[model samples]
Target: MHHWKPPPPLSLSLRSCRFVLSFTPAPAMSASSSSEVAPTGPADAIYRDRILSSKLYFDVPPSKVPVIYSSSYDIAFFGIEKLHPFDSSKWGRICQFLIKEGFLDKKQTVEPLEASNDDLLVVHSESYLSSLKSSLNVAIIIEVPPVSLLPNCLVQNKVLYPFRKQVGGSILAAKLAKERGWAINIGGGFHHCSAEKGGGFCAYADISLCIQFAFVLLNISRVMIIDLDAHQGNGHEIDFSNDRRVYILDMYNAGIYPFDFEAKRYIDQKVELASGTKTKEYLDKLDEALEVARNNFNPELVVYNAGTDILDGDPLGRLKISPDGVTTRDEKVFRFARERNIPLLMLTSGGYMKSSARVIADSIINLSKKNLIALDSPLGRK
Candidate 1:
């Protein structure tokens, strides 16, 4: 396994917390299990049964496009969401912009169901799920102080409910991509949360859950995660650390949040960027990284964590990439997958600025213009 050497220490900021992570290999699956055996492990059986019984994977009619979103995906709790830097309503705005611009028809967009307790259990442990019932734990995970004071029931209904809806979107996106070649979840990419832990404003392991569901339902074995979010995607990295079926290509500002040196060891291909890196250098590195990733792994599916946080002027990302750079980046990734005929699913991961919605909508428009993704087909036209 490839290991990343930690960079020299730098001046610390409020958002940048440095931590050394110890690498521990997860326990291996038993050798007694073979293709001939019915795969009888209790843990494996529970996970498989949960996935097979999930309502998140319901069939969408031919009239609807593969773009997944729901009005319930937006979180607003007595205006307390304003306390956090994240734009809680960004998901809704992205879809609104696309509809107003004629790039998409509102009637054709698919609305996803909220992920239930059983669905979450496929990736999250029972204890971890129980921990979320504490309003204090949830507030800490989401980084909103006011949320801790609210009753656990209210918090669950208002805040975590929206996130669970987004999780459903992410999981469903994989299935849609398999059937349609490409799909996008307007929200999701909680890359900071894992099966047993939640941090960095991420409460659930959506990426990990999505891939797990894909492995079971889509009949896909090899998967690649192309996480271009500004922050390191430690959540999925940690979850898939011992699992060889997933290949991770993570490129992010190394100086940013969740500076997990341990999780860095899990990345199949790690591309670290410095603070305030400009657009030209960012795009150049991505081009090369994609080339190397192509040469290295042949995957049945590609999960692209397209975070707009890398946009210029974003306070959180600390990178200086421009709006057009974001568009070009998405285009390049789409082209890469399209050319290879590989199924791809994109998640709008993290971007705190309000303008993130516009940039994302524009990028989707650009993709449509380039014929990289079809927003509407004659058969699906409304």
Candidate 2:
């Protein structure tokens, strides 16, 4: 195996950078124009009111770019994270690479607020939120056995707190995307956890919460979830199963974890890849799938769960897609949304390997090179 190291920080020159101003406004829909009725029941009323009153969707100035992250998003608890297969610090590492490469300005990157309990209740059940109070439940959900032995207070501070912060980032990203045409939340896409349950290292249903907020606050009637993670995004699948307003296109390894047969039924477009699937086959399927999805549903917004677990050496994903393939995959997805003039919010979901952070950082740089995403800062150039 090749040893991985953080790339040396690049000294950049502003003259070498390219700038093109392009903005696509979201499709207009009045806030009061929903075909759905207002909430009648107590539970629905509370949820609706919480969403309406939440400050998570605060305005982001145009001067700042639409990449959302926070230092709190990285989880570390005295080496307990090392017990799991996942690289818990990958979120911070991704940002570090981008900053070191001069692709991003640390000050310009938007830091999101932590999702309060009321904000989380927008999608998660009260019982589900309460269950997280126990370290054992959180441990089981995150697949970290030693976490169970840790005190609940430590777990809450070290683990779930970071997740809540990321959840806030995911929720805010939709609002940013609608305004900016595209946004990326560096630390979200917890797609294995639904409103009622958490599993597969995903403790919160950020995708569901994001879409829900978009539907209500952004005046977005239709949304598409393009989950290209190596594992099935059963959490969001189950959340939006009966909702016609949401269309799901999930391309994942069929033989992998969370092989949820039930969630399979909810995918509008399911591209299941076998173990050892190559880059060509994967990209080919994604191309065809995107075409089909475009013909099937015209969405106002697109939620892309851009997971890097499909990287060749990722043990969990079991796919042979190269680093270049990952970049190409993201580019295609961005192009698809750009062509449609639809706003897109991308979340960095799964991929536990140490190299995952570099791969993701490289992919974002590739997107910038292709002009699919614009890093507006002058610091990152050449």
Candidate 3:
């Protein structure tokens, strides 16, 4: 209902513009119906620096459309916020499978949680929150598809809790990174949310608000949001476009979702990698990303969106990167963050291909880990 004025105009190379997919909007749902569902995964994890790390709380549903705007399948799969209901078990199944593959620590498991209204206010409107409450009170017929990620704020206390939990994971991730050192939020990658509105595939006020809030609470000066989700961080790009304190490193395909509302910012970088880009070529492109992040944006605190869709064989992705390629990508990016001694915060932005998703998650986890990032739960910690 609100018209957003984009920041300044930023342009990518015309030659970089490659294939753009045509997708129709999924059927819309009444506000009340939207609140009743949850995404599938561990309830409150992905807040750590690892894939199976105690940070990711995956309640997201996977049935929604996979990530767009990339030629890389791993990039597209990493774009998936929630797993399909049918694929819900597949998430843990993938987790366990990774355990079998020696990729994940065998001790990890995910659970569920319902967040509070106060927790949600960090990113969403109070009106939307109240509406979600009233819907859950009346128990209206839930009509939306099980695969959808964005839910309406007009349902039961239980249904609406996932938003809070997901955001809580993001907020807590930022808080942990600020307090201890570094953290990764696996679920909350809502990079496209403007202050009041949600666009592109990003819904739910996740990382955007967390940092916006940290500017005050955490006193974060010169925070960097490095969005590698394969789509321009249109919402985030638009939000911090004019501000010099926050820099955006968005490496996404040109001319894609959220319709590119013509936004620009200081020290932002976007590189286009086309479909069927071989592993070595993508690695070369990553070197460009490294130069841009290090040389252009000398960040004190770096928020890394470790999207998993850059892999090959991703149903929703167009790029042809293999699992090893994705791992290498994570290594290069993580190494860059680690070597600089920059405090890092990360998230599993998007994902689809389950097996490859597990690999990317596990690989990054293997690299950027501290021995102390353990489960908050006493039993798990013990």
Candidate 4:
């Protein structure tokens, strides 16, 4: 398919922007082909440009230190409810830091998502799709307040279609990573959403959909998911359990989101992290988890859920990990996967701070840097 033109810049006071993206195989098209070219349109959006945009993009450190990550994406505003809220809330401090460094700017480019039925089917059901079309999407998923259940009226008619925008962002991030190598979505990692009913705090199975889409469209089989989110990667487990090729390292509270009352019959590899778990403990568990990924479910591409909510201050996070510790968690996950050339597709999951007035959006960007620099760079030196 031909790549489309990008959209315009954001209305917010921003300095710079980078296009978010995914990785997929370059169709028979040559490297120099215009189709093979990076994003262009309103502001030359690409995950690299946006992520690397640094302070101009957010209030974080200048991207000057040269971290890691770079991939194409169409997430501009694709993440359902995750985007606008993430930008304003406790993420302000991080945004200030980026601004101090010039990673972000008012002129940054942005765009919404576009998820197709074919992609949604990678993990969802047709009957469920019909239910979504009937606007039962959000309602079936969460009972939070009087939420609209469906997104906007236009696509809201098709329940999954609106949520597809968020799904499409993941698809774009993964495609950018697979094709160009290394992709990420500032928003996404809806792991609790299942094939039928969305669970816990999730409404869509993004990682599951992306993995299945990779299986069908990309024709790549045997995928692995390294879920380090504060919560269990339950959605992925239930979706890819029988496949065997897809393994899960779900490190979460034993009874948080999915509410594992007795047993979790769907999960492949589950790890219950005790509450108040600190950086050292989480890293130890992460190392063990990586060993599992490397030894057992060693697949071609590894879909990593780099959730930062595991940090100590995260409202939804039960663990007591710190900011540097959050970086460490990401460092361990990305290094382990990238060292072996395992294509990684990352999405930000649950992260709510006890102090909503001061969140750390930089943790997300920091992971993107590790995504880019951890390998060839001296940033994460021994």
Best by TM-score: 1
Give candidate 4's error at residue 151 in angstroms.
Answer: 11
lDDT of 3 by residue, 26-76 (tens): 111221231212213442221111212322233322221111111111111
Local accuracy of candidate 4 as per-residue lDDT tens digits, 199-276: 544667778667655543444566667777777665666565444455566677653555532124445566777678
Ranking by lDDT: 1, 2, 4, 3
Weakest ten-residue segment in model 2 by summed lDDT: 18-27
TM-score, one value per model: 0.91, 0.89, 0.64, 0.66
Residues 1-382, model 1: lDDT tens digits: 0012234544423212324332212222322221111235777777788888999998888888889999999999999999888899999999999999998998888899899999998888889999999999998888888899999999999999999999999999999998888999999999988888898778999999998888778867678999999988989988877766778999998876777666777788888899899999999999999999999888889999999999889888889999999999999999899889998999999997899999999999999888888897623211
Q: Which is superior by lDDT, 2 or 4?
A: 2
Q: List the RMSD of every prediction in angstroms.
A: 5.5, 10.9, 13.4, 13.9
**Which window of ten consecutive residues has the lowest lDDT sum in model 4?**
1-10
Q: What is the C-alpha local distance difference test score of each model?
A: 0.85, 0.83, 0.48, 0.51
What global local distance difference test value does model 4 have? 0.51
| Best lDDT among the predictions, by candidate number | 1
- What lDDT, from 0 to 1, does candidate 1 have? 0.85
Select the stronger candidate by TM-score from 3 and 4: 4
Worst 10 residues of 3 by lDDT: 65-74
TM-score of structure candidate 2 = 0.89
Pairs with backbone N, CA or C atoms under 3 Å apart (clashes), candidate 2: none
